[model samples]
Target: MLDIRPIGRSMLNKVPEVTLVFWLIKIMSTTVGETGADYLAVHVGLGTSVTGLLMITLLAAVLAIQLRMDRYVPWVYWLTVVLVSIVGTQITDALTDKLEISLYVSTAAFAIALAATFAIWFSVERTLSIHSIVTQRRELFYWAAILFTFALGTAAGDLATEALGLGFNVGVVAFTALIAAIAAAYALGANAVLTFWLAYILTRPLGASFGDLLSQAREYGGLGFGTIYTSLAFLTVIVALVAWLSFEADAGGKPEASPGA
Candidate 1:
């Protein structure tokens, strides 16, 4: 029925090497993920556990299909990302809502999970380079880390807004500033891998806070746009970007690293 092959020494056809556009799209996607998850849970009348379970099931199936494919396809890659985004948002929501876990505790827990994931990933692959994600093991680690980032982002964002007494708009501004600072650091001799991962982690909270700012009601200190509107706007932008990239450039931009290098 389905081919379940392990990735090996062959070259990787990942969606794109990390670039400015890549980060832009990533933040947009994560924001959509946050809003979309909230929409499903609240607007659709599905509780957090139900929504999380449903999204996780769907993500699992999509990931299975993605893993089955021998090479990366843009649509497939983006779809997988979208699903993972929802599931990741659900994870944090479940912990915070259902379990009554504090934001700081969830943040610490997710941080530990992410760190453990990286340790195992590096120990197994002997390299944490995103360009080298040609192996099934590497891909698994990558996805796992991504899921953790979203959860960690949710917790971290909540901590900033709630625990730290910064409102949503202020949180967004703070995270935006942090991201800009990280970019500057990356430009000034910081390790590419380190900077890339650091930025990757930061973008999650940045996007999540922005999503809340756009989607939540004004009484909640947001713009009162609603989740559906926010999701639609972000999805539309994402689709446009994908379509443009498909026709204008290759699936992704120029290669970051050569195969087998």
Candidate 2:
């Protein structure tokens, strides 16, 4: 069994409480990740390589600030997440579009990488629960796992929707159904940690599909909203929610992290 110690959960925890709001931000961040990366690479003409470097540098700076903090600050934490989302998408895009690597190969490699991260994390800390990320080492492992999940999700999602010709609409429905099934399993007494990770991985692709559905041209089976409108709209909602969560935390209305079994 995985160890899930609840001892130092109060002020030491570095992550936010896993709740509906948390998932909402997560999904939308991923949507921004998908559309935002494309817009910068193609529309703004930075290309994936250059945009990746800038985003990676920005992510490193934000992560440094995040690490220096002792407790979870809503803006700082979510900013780190948003950066991670963009960087992750860039990483996968570089491999697929520039290097001409197959999505299947990239997807498999990221899966193995994520598994290895968890294996080492569990070995060193004896716990894989987000609730136990009260130390710098644990937080490092968590972030590594997160990066891989997003990269892997990008590859897998691209394989399904584009390579396999599922199109954006069907991809959205398929991934959403899969997430619903995972939720049902969790409700039926599945291990919380396992289900949490599963749902987390699935949401990346679900959000990507949804992003494409909104941002792509109508001829390509989308709503023709364009990347600018889609990204700006989602980012607006994300900002409002983060501010609200920050206020709630100030009011001592914090939510608890999810259970880890």
Candidate 3:
């Protein structure tokens, strides 16, 4: 009985705003990234390198699909995010566990990659706001930065837990505190772009730590529920949320312009 034409139009201009729902889902996805990667590498009997490679392949395919999309589809965009999160976690794990790379080096590499992506993105597109995703180059840079954030988050999380002996609980606390601080700055009228990006990067580690808390063994100071169960739970939530967002849109809907406008 309702008009249904607007849904397609809504997706063409920009992504959804940085709402609480967005942050909640983003954190959940990142948490799954940590646990899901570990499940494949450890429980599934695949070596870290193999698992990383497999995830990377899957990520590449998903990204290609995402790139070809003319506009944002809630399901398509979120699926890409979830896949990239898995791939990012694997990349950090491979570097640290398989190649014996130091966390510092991996973190630095990810930071550099993030910077380069931004540099190219801004140089080519002239704007990095999510509200202005009007071109392919901007989208490319967005995805690239997202990938690096997950990788950097993994490396930073591990470094805190392993190299510094901070433990998982502490790591979660630290990352959470940082995110809160960033949010406070944003509330105080700091640049939305800067605050949003800072919080975005930090959320990866915060979510990763929470995932470790939920899925790791009790001996390792976790609940030991295992990754499969955790991933399933999160995936269910993701599906439900995406479905709700899709159904709630007006006909010929347009995605709201993000606050970063």
Candidate 4:
């Protein structure tokens, strides 16, 4: 069996430290993912097929750079994540819109994919902790899991808000409550790794719900800000936060480096 213990102290892992800023940026990136994909597909007249291909290409390039890096580079890592989010959203959108698949079916499919990814990852690596993402194999698993989470989030969010008639605002509230409960459970001594992954998965839907709430038409239970404006605003915030993290890292106040597994 693969060893579960932390590895050498000097080796740097590719992922960032889990902190308040990390969560903040993660939510913002997810929101951008939702709105950005909509903007490109609808407003920009690219259609889901074209937009998906473009975003997937970009995500592939960015991920290649990220994988080649020796350590956690804030800008590269977050850019890859943002692109992944967009591509993941487009994936679900294509399945539901173009293929005419039901949101319920897509959600169940993505959930199964995520669960299988986790099971295989743990079976091979002996750990699912982000802190143990040292080997290239583990990093591949991590990215695969992240992609499925975003896709699952898109399907689940749409299923709740659109298919179930709960509306965007209600979906946001429901997901927010779930995340808060997860946080409470973690505080009460829930398994750290489990709680972390649960919260991570839930945040994608929460952020996507909020994205629709802000960007959809007023008649559609939203604020009517529209996708373009909402995407730009959230993208600005994401850029600012990533820049701050980069500045901090350059100032010799880098986040704690994860040891190799």
Predicted structure with the largest TM-score when compared to the true one: 2
Q: Which lDDT tens digits does candidate 1 get at residues 1-261?
A: 766675564546554656666777899999998999988888999989889889888898899887876556566677788888788888888888899998889999999999999999889889777777777777888889888887888788888888898988999999989888977987787777777787888888889889999999999999999999999999998888777666544744534443211
Candidate 4 displacement at residue 63 in angstroms? 0.4
Q: lDDT tens string, model 2, 85-202? A: 9999999999999999999999999999999999999999998888888877788898999999899888999999999999999999999999999999989999888888888888
lDDT of 1 at 164: 94
Residue 225, candidate 3: C-alpha displacement in angstroms: 1.6
Model 3 lDDT tens row, 38-150: 88888898978888888888887777777666666777788889889999998888888778999999999998989888788788777777777655656767888899989
Question: Which pairs clash in the backbone of model 3?
Answer: 5-252, 6-251, 6-252, 6-253, 7-252, 7-253, 10-253, 10-254
By lDDT, who's the top model here?
Answer: 2
| Candidate 2 displacement at residue 70 in angstroms | 1.0
TM-score of predicted model 4?
0.93
Off by over 4 Å in 2: 1-11, 253-258
| TM-score (C-alpha) between model 1 and the true structure | 0.93
Winner on TM-score between 1 and 4 is 4
By how many angstroms RMSD does model 2 differ from the true structure? 4.7
Alpha-carbon RMSD to native, per candidate: 2.4, 4.7, 5.2, 4.6
The CA lDDT of each predicted structure is: 0.82, 0.90, 0.82, 0.88
Q: Model 2 has how many clashing residue pairs?
A: 0
Model 2 pairs whose backbones collide: none
Query: Which sequence of candidate numbers ranks them by TM-score, best first?
Result: 2, 4, 1, 3
